[model samples]
Target: MSGSFGGQSAGGAKKARIEIIPLIDVIFFLLATFVLFTLSLDKIQSVPVDLPQATPAARPITEDDLVVLQISEPGTAYWNRELISSTEIPRRLLDYKATVPAPRVLVSGDDKARYGDAVLALDEVRKAGITVSIETAFRATGR
Candidate 1:
């Protein structure tokens, strides 16, 4: 009797083949998951409000109507070019709002001013219901 020492049957050994279908499916699934995650990153949650409509006959605002609120490095606040205390911001904002028909404010600060002082002034302006803008250009002195 002939002896077959190798663990192969009478048929020759089958060739090893790589199955790529499942690998392609797994790669596609990972790509899809990453795409979906990236798409959701920019979702913004915000409250809805009814915005005011503009009129064609509305009067244009002049430079004289602009109010500049400046904050200094020493934690003092300024209304236009006048120095003021921090505690007086809210009262002044409210008074300005009541006096000006279309109140507008420009919040500015010295380059070395405290961030909290500027934010405090901005918060007061918002609470007074006035239109506000920020001054991005910095000056050596608070103005």
Candidate 2:
């Protein structure tokens, strides 16, 4: 039973078409959001400078004492006498801290090294839940 119009044909409903304009807009918005977020992360940039001098009493660093972290030339770093990438520092420190009885860290940076690298190392170590202390060499005073 159908309409008796001039030439009427009856069939099922038509399929809906996807609108690409809105999809493109959404993709663009996501791209913009990601770009903005990445740009904002630069605010965490580290400062480069020689730390102030302090007169510290002679304290012996026993074998079980502070763990050493060194930043050497050519962008190489060492943790506890092991060579590891900078990104791996935090995870390694966490693992080390879990096993060590007294977990302490000392960051010693080369004077010729980039200060940002040193700060980043320190930040990672601190985030790993270990106490951090920076090493400063004190020159002998003339009598």
Candidate 3:
């Protein structure tokens, strides 16, 4: 009766076996749940713009023929993430209009930005002579 060292259960050789079916089932369940949870979510892609809210209406019709013009609070302007002088916008828009047909433009001005700065950006767009849409956030009213 060697206590535990040589003690063998009355059954034959006890081989340590790792059961993996339960682990696989749990992994699959978690993966499936995560995918299903995010499947119904709408993707809202945009540059960070602290835009003033307005009535829910038409949104920017983003497409391949689109140019995003952003004006920051410091009066700095960007063209699709590329820093560009406000003076450069007109030239660039003219160049694009020459190569492309009917390019759409979206102008986004920060809420804290100077009113003159927003007007200046819009003015540049106007000078370019391309149809421009002012981008704004949707403020829901009465639920």
Top candidate when judged by TM-score against the true structure: 1
lDDT of 2 at 71: 69
Cα displacement (angstroms), candidate 1, residue 70, comes to: 0.6
Q: Supply the global lDDT for candidate 3.
A: 0.72
Ranking by lDDT, best first?
1, 2, 3
Candidate 2 residue lDDT tens string, 1-143: 66444444355445457999999999999999999999888566788999889766456556676777876554567676666667777787888888886688978765555688889888888788788988775212110
lDDT, residue 7, model 2: 42
Model with the higher lDDT, candidate 1 or 2: 1
- Give the per-residue lDDT of model 1 (tens digit) for 1-143: 35443554446565456889999999999999999999889778999999999677378888777899888866587788888888888888888888888899999888768888888888888888998999898765754
C-alpha lDDT of all candidate models, in order: 0.83, 0.73, 0.72
**TM-score, predicted candidate 1 vs. hidden true structure:** 0.58
Instruction: Give the poorly placed runs of model 3, Cα more than 4 Å off.
Output: 1-62, 138-143
- The C-alpha local distance difference test score for the whole of candidate 1 amounts to 0.83
How displaced is residue 90 in candidate 1, in Å?
Answer: 0.7
Clashing pairs in 3: none
RMSD per prediction, one decimal? 7.9, 20.5, 15.5
Clashes of each: 0, 0, 0
- lDDT per residue for candidate 3 within 1-143, as digits (tens), equals 43334434545455566899999999999999999989978999979979887666365444667887777656367687777766677788898788767777878765545678778778877887888899786312111
In candidate 1, position 87 carries an lDDT of 86
